[model samples]
Target: MCDYTQREYSCGHFRWIASKWCREYTLTHKRCQPNVTHFEYRADEPCGECKPKEYPPWENLIRRNKQATY
Candidate 1:
């Protein structure tokens, strides 16, 4: 089973998403700062409280970096 995490965005949004340590720590990939506010082990239910941001703030940083390299 995949690990699920409760993360908070810089915009104060929160979401329960799959935990991907490689994506978070790998330097070659775009970093997604889903500040893991909590970890839900054996999460059988979805979060119904916190609303997630429509767009992650870190996406912008990735776009900028790609443009600079081009």
Candidate 2:
């Protein structure tokens, strides 16, 4: 399983990022900083702080793609 977590920004943006690796350094040092793989305005529940904006066609595509994965 992948080690990761979801974080919510003050701007009402949600992002999925790496958490930690299980194994120690072996052959090569490949430590990676927490990286954001996805980002989007919360659609299920709107936040008043950021007052969500409508998704454009491209962003809608991203939203749909993200939905498909999970």
Candidate 3:
């Protein structure tokens, strides 16, 4: 397997979007903030990231993972 220079993560919330979001997703990369490891997606396999076909982003959700620490 190949490991990119980046990573991926998410958060767990009880009342809000997880108060720990501050602890997680707080890494800095490429001068940006997506402090998580995002797997390299093949041109034909973009679905691998959100596998199990459930975490699809609807018109109401955004990919603010800026470092998902889940």
12-42 in candidate 2: lDDT tens per residue? 6665656555354233456545444444444
lDDT (C-alpha, whole model) for all candidates: 0.52, 0.54, 0.34
Tens digit of per-residue lDDT, candidate 1, span 10-66: 445556775655544565556455555455443343344443446676776753443
Error of 3 at 45 (Å): 5.1
- Cα lDDT of candidate 2 equals 0.54
Q: Which ten residues in a row have the lowest lDDT in candidate 3?
A: 11-20
What's model 1's lDDT at 64?
Answer: 46
Instruction: State every prediction's TM-score relative to the real structure.
Output: 0.23, 0.28, 0.16
Candidate number that wins on lDDT, 1 or 2: 2
- Better by lDDT, candidate 3 or 1: 1
Candidate 3 regions off by >4 Å? 1-20, 24-32, 45-70
Task: Report how far off residue 31 is in candidate 3 (Å).
Answer: 13
Who wins the TM-score comparison? 2
lDDT of 1: 0.52
- Candidate 1 Cα misplacement greater than 4 A, ranges: 20-70
